[model samples]
Target: MTSNKTDLPYFSVVGIGAGPANLSLAALLQARTDQRIALFDKAADSSWHSSLLHPGVRMQTSWMKDLVSLVDPTHKLSFLNYLVTEGRLFAMINSQFDVIPRREYMRYLAWASGQIENIHYSTPIEEVSFVEGEGFYAISGGAPVARSQHLVIGVGTRPTVPAGLSSLPDDRAFIADHLALHLPTMSSDKTAPVAVIGGGQTGIEAVLRLLGAGFSNIKWLGRRQWFQTIDDSPAANEIYRPAHQQYLQDLTRGTRRRLVEDANPTGDALTPGVLRTLYQANYDRMLEFGEYPVAMLPGRDVTEGVLDGKDVVLHCSTAERLEQHRVAYAVIAVGRQSAPVPFSAELRERLDAGEDGDLVIEEDYSVRWKGMDDHRIYALNRARFSHGIPDANLTLLPVRAAMVINSMLGSELFQIRDELCPVQWG
Candidate 1:
């Protein structure tokens, strides 16, 4: 809670988190010498997909979908560059697929992070508030810093656990986020059944990992009638084309949300290959012995579960009937919620008053706050409702980074037009 007014040599852009999204931004800004930028991560080191990293887990998207290719294909720090540096570029080319092992991808990201300067690791951003006179933000924590230009909040998502299970005492029930670290410690006794909840990518991946770990009995509970596959058709991906940007702009809010919801099953769901692998593994294990019996409890919800002696008694309500299953542990692969960013009382007050609360920005991603015309705060993942589905996911990291950089440079550095799309309608 301290403030300082000193003439600094550089105009700063402060990023709240050091995930792939913010990391991409840091790389883009690093090329510019006139501006100084800083990236902060609360973790001791850079990491992604910590859980669901089974022995053979592969990336759903190709290496071309990395942080820089979609934005700047020519960037030397792209994943292709990392592949070449690691001597895996030729091996990857021979594989005839763009995807690589998840562990290798993490290694690439870590290597890229090391090449960037002014990144503060192990330092968490506690709070960010604006100073009126300076027309800048005061970021407190990890060596006090302030920025006179812009602040990007890319903290990423939080794990979403079921409402009732939050207070459960059993250490056996876990989320997908911690699955990798905790899975190895699990007992391998055949009597212990592992229940995996959810049928999305993370859930399916977790189930496959558990089976790979030699777990005998496992159950998968999902609300969907069956596991869905993402639509990889060229026409479907056309939604990402520049022509569709105008279409997305014209739609109303409700229409835009519906479009996202409808398109999610095809774009964000589990890949067909991953699903096939899971099915094949289940069959293989079943043929050898009744070792990995995957009971697909579709259209079912886990109403209650508690520790009953040495087992977990799970009460589930299916579409037709209520059933119970006893298992050793449960893994909730429910994915994540938006991460919280600390805003000062002054900014929060303006949002509370509903004036400049729903701040609108032109396609450049400049945020409009009350009583502020020149000072713009650029938020990355927080604009999902306005910016479409690409805001939070890694799929749009490169595009978003290019836009942010373009806006900062006050010109079309990437040659993208400034036209805003039509307002979406329901």
Candidate 2:
């Protein structure tokens, strides 16, 4: 570890993690103001959800909701501009996709990231501390790399496997992201059985990937009674608007949490297009094999797993009774939990946290800390219950960034206007 240095590069804002959230903020700050900004990420290069960009997989949100479009459509880094600049405008127009492919979105983000300035790649910030009079310092490699008046935490979530499956052999049972890496080691026979645990979008995607890999016997398990598609109706979409988010903030904490829980189906379920594609593919395989290649086992809550000879046996509890499934391999796609914010012990003690041990975020996404008079810390993608479902996904990417910018600048840098609301939250 290198020694701490007093003289470090100074910036108006030092953002950790070059994911979509900070990238959105960086693009906006570059376009709207001349403030000194820097973004640091641990990855070697720009990529978004790299492991999960399976063939035929698509984004759940529309293309219009790119990094800088919804708030500042004229921004040079808009998704439309990327296509036009890259000579794919006409091709994209002709494709006429309801939602663009996930690979395409990843490519767009990489392109936009290339145009942004002061983004430090392959640099992982270990801890952030405050110096009282000197603002915030981002420490990396046991020394201060950058100092800034503000810090943004965007070190996105990580895939999680439950405690029961945690002890499973890594070579046999692993997270969904490792499916491709572990696939070739498993059986090459198309009829070999494999199990995909989790019923949400990621689980379905894993099952689809297995199908593409010619795995005829696939067990798809989930806790839900049945595989459910997203609620894509206009009324359901209203939950993602700025108006609904503002109204949610006005309610009591208990009421807001309950309302957000009720609104999960709007954005948390599987995409309708992907579900339809899976159904059609399953039907096509059934026509040739006289039976379905994939067996849908919903309403089963997976409880434990243990090795049985060469097979991994999964024990689950259903609505009726307990059951067991023996498979060659299991892909766990349960869910994701937030990656921790590496705050120094002193700094963390000065900050306020919620009952869930997350930062107490303000309306503008800034944290409620003890000594925030001279400096501030803003967190994105960490405010789902407070900001609603849009906080977790890419639906209102730029709008959220605009709110953070306006709050940082102490002015209406971007006017967020949502009009003609038919539904009354009151």
Candidate 3:
């Protein structure tokens, strides 16, 4: 009757990656049960997109959508509580920002993580394998750290560089994250032009930072015909509510997928505040220098390119014509793909996946996998097509976490209720 750490009793849950997704789940489940639950993250410290915390850059999502507030407003870990405890509630209210700074969100996450129990930092879970008799063994550091009855994958995303830049040395082109680090080492010549490829918010932010730093020539290229902002209109917001999510559940999978594509502006678009700021900054520069520093190049689908001497050449196809742009540097701000689940080969085969080989996440965020009788696998921020926009957004994090917790416990500890909706969909 003895056991090592590998043979430890089955934990209630083992969450991979202590990002907001799994942190939300850990927060909501704190009071519900005394059963063992823990989060293991590869990062040595609690830093959420640390390098991307550019100055004056704010969160695209609202602060009210903090980890636990949306689901349980009265929860101790609510953002309001964080503000009060840190004695910055009044200062924050006076700032009157449309959205909170991402730095604050990161701090809040770290605070929440500190309060929670059994979070293993710097411990990267190498593989997760399932056995017939046992629940799930999560291996890390060449040993099984814990056995879990349930698994939650929240590995999050990484910056992606296009294959076109593969031939270039690392010194030339890089993802948006390295921009801040690269800036200090760059030449101080103000008129030296740079390019930000990809029209999403990240690209917009990069363009703004360069403009602010006195770069007279900056190219902001996006595939969309024109840069778009998040449509926070009342009607557009209707889709983000739980009622619409329930409606999405009823539609055929194909229809839901199509609608999810159409609902892009709800979360993935640029924020109006940032947009206005960029325009105003550009206008002020025009008044002072008689020309705007930032050039907006929309509808340019950058397919391939090469390094030409001191500059990088980007070949893009616009609707009307094909063109080549040369710049001192290129910043890739394209959208990110989901981080792959670290499921073992056997578990991967047993799990149901779509044509793209992505895990087929169910409505409850659970995956349909064979040989996982009572054990379950829940993926957070990995089901954009299946669960609509909310799947990859922070707007409904706690709600999703609560649903997972309920599913894991086989009881509705938190009743999900969203009534009196204005929009009705088939």
The prediction achieving the highest TM-score against the true structure is 2
Estimate every model's Cα lDDT from 0 to 1.
Answer: 0.72, 0.91, 0.86
Screening candidate 3 with a backbone cut-off below 3 angstroms (N, C-alpha, C), the clashing residue pairs are: none
TM-scores of the candidates in the order shown: 0.89, 0.98, 0.96
Model 3 misplaced regions, further than 4 Å? 1-10
Better of 1 and 2 by TM-score: 2
Candidate 2's displacement at residue 90, Å, is 1.0
Error of 1 at 313 (Å): 3.0
| Residue pairs with backbone overlap in model 2 | none
- Across 135-239, the per-residue lDDT of candidate 3 in tens digits comes to 788888877888888899999988777787667655667788988999886668878878899888889989988887789899899998899989999998888
RMSD over all Cα atoms, model 2: 1.4
Candidate 1 segments exceeding 4 Å error: 7-10, 135-143, 290-292, 352-362, 417-426
lDDT of 1: 0.72
Candidate 3 global TM-score: 0.96
lDDT: worst 10-residue window of model 3: 1-10
Q: lDDT per residue, candidate 2, 1-426, as tens digits?
A: 233446678899999999999999999999989998999998989989898878889999999989999989999999999999999999989999998999999999999999999999988999998886688888877778898999989998999889999998998799999988888887877787899999999999999999998899999999989988899999999998999999999988789999999998998899999999999999999999898999999999999989888789999999999999999888999989999889989999999978887799988999999987668799999999998999998999899999989988889989998999999987
